[model samples]
Target: MIEVHQFACLSDNYGYLVHDRASGETVCIDTPDAEACLAAARARGWTITQVWNTHWHPDHAGGNLAVKAATGCTITAPAGDSARIEGIDRTVDGGDTVTIGALTAEVIAVGGHTLGHVAYHLPEAGIAFVGDALFALGCGRMFEGTPEQFWASLARLKALPPETRIHCAHEYTQSNARFAVHADPDNAALAAYAAEVTERRSIGLPTVPMPLDRELACNPFLRADDPALQARWGCGDAVATFAALRAAKDGFR
Candidate 1:
């Protein structure tokens, strides 16, 4: 079993500590703050062995050097962006598999927010560490890729098992829900999820590790193929629905 610990850092960014219970080896996904990750690992009596980066963003990969120096851990990053990411020892692409004790994680290339974005899926543990790709109720902003690429990336994630737990690297569910409601007003699932997310935030709880199927029902971006979204956006196509939803989200605030 892999134990996941969420580290709140750099305002709302999340750094996940994945520990293999059998081996007592810990691997951090997107280390936004190295000190916080170091403290978390030490407190749990787990030896840090690897640092996995989803993208080359400063907020996600900034602490790679610091953590490597402290733990002498190997840094694994996307092959496409290895040149940009510092201290990357092994660069993995889609179809690559990473192992931790008895668990194996598969690599997925889901570039949209960045040119080299990736996600790690641990089938044995039924968890996916998607950096800024698929969020609870929102998708990442298309910074370096086109809408077509972004939609394609999201489709890849949608193909995962419904029971797969999503672990995104941010606490944006509340805001995402609000925007989702605006984009898809008639969606009862969206409205219901928004209310639940509001309560969860009010209680200072992390709204993550959400089931993929639940997000598929409530998240407008994830439900681009739904009839409600298609009708509201005036299109039955996934790409058009995705564009309309993204535009709505951008102007939500």
Candidate 2:
């Protein structure tokens, strides 16, 4: 079994520790806060041996050096943006496979949030750790990439099996849910999910890891191809539809 331990770090950011029982190895995905990540691993009695980063964002990779120094962990990060991330010992891109113990995780290049953003997917484990690439009802803001690049990145994720669990980096689901309902008011699934999110947050719950299938049905960013949304935006091309949705979401509050 792959044991996943999630904890809050640096405001809305989340840190995850994936422990492979078979190999007695542990991998920490992203270092939002070094102390928090190290503490979580200590609490589990697991010594982190590897640190994998999704992008070069400070919030994501800021603690890389600190964590690696503390645990002697090897740091693996995106090759495309390796220069920006501190202390990256191994650089990987899409199509590369990383391992922790007996488990294998495929690295997928998912630019847009950052031109070199990546996601790590363990197909057998049915999990993907996506840092700021895809979020629960929304996608990351276009920072260094264009809408076309981001649209393509999203397609890479959409092609994954619907049952895959998406472990996003931040807790933006509640606000994203509000925008999702606003973008596609007729979506019953989104309305229902919004209600559920409201309840979850009301009791201080986290909604980071959500099923891909649920996002496919209700997330407006993923539903850009829907005829209804296409009609609303008066666009037929998927990229255009996505751009329109992004613009609407940018101004949605």
Candidate 3:
């Protein structure tokens, strides 16, 4: 079995620890805070042996040095922007396979948030650690990539199996749900999910690790291809619909 532990860091960011029970191999996916990751590992009595980076963003890879110094863990990161990342012992790209004991994940080039952004997918485990490419009810802002590029990246992820549990890197679900409700007002799934998100956040619970299928039904960004929605939003096609939605969300409260 694969065990995962999630914790908060640097305000809204999240850090993750993955453990493969069969081989007792533990890995940390992106290091928002090395201290938080180390502490989480210590609490579980698990020793981290590897660190897998999804991108070169400072918030995600900033703790690489500290984590390596403390755990002596090997670091594998994206080769797309290796020049920007530090302490990467091994670099991989889209379609490359990485391992955690017996489990393997394919590195998906999900570049939109960053040129080197990647997503780790363990198909057998029915889970993925998508950095900033796809969010719960939203997608990442078009910072370093084009709207069309971001749309393409999102389309790849949206096609994944429905049951795939997405482990994104932030706690932006509440805000995303709000934007979703506004963008896709007639979507029953979005409305219900917004209510649920409101309740969960009211009590201080994390709203991550969401199922992909639910997001497909509720997330406005994912519905850009729907002909009805496209007409409603005054978009000519999926790409244009995506741009309109992203632009709207950028200025949304």
Q: Best candidate per lDDT, number?
A: 2
lDDT of 2 by residue, 32-95 (tens): 9999999999988999999999999999999998998898999999998898999888999999
Clash-forming residue pairs, model 2 = none
**lDDT value, candidate 3, whole model:** 0.90
- lDDT (CA) per prediction: 0.89, 0.92, 0.90
Candidate 1's residue-wise lDDT over 1-253, tens digit each?
7799887888999888999888877899977999988998888887789999999998999999999999999999998778889999999988998888789999999988988899999988999999998899999998888888889889989999999999999999989887888887887877888999999899999898799999888888988988767887898798888987887787779
How much is 219 displaced in model 1, in angstroms? 0.6
State the RMSD for candidate 2: 0.8
Clashes of each: 0, 0, 0
Worst window of 10 by summed lDDT in candidate 3? 181-190
Worst 10 contiguous positions by lDDT, candidate 1 = 243-252
**Full candidate order by TM-score, most accurate first:** 2, 3, 1
The parts of candidate 2 lying over 4 Å away from their true place are none
Question: Residue-wise lDDT of candidate 3 within 140-159, one digit each (tens)?
Answer: 88888877888888888988
Q: Rank the candidates by lDDT, best first.
A: 2, 3, 1
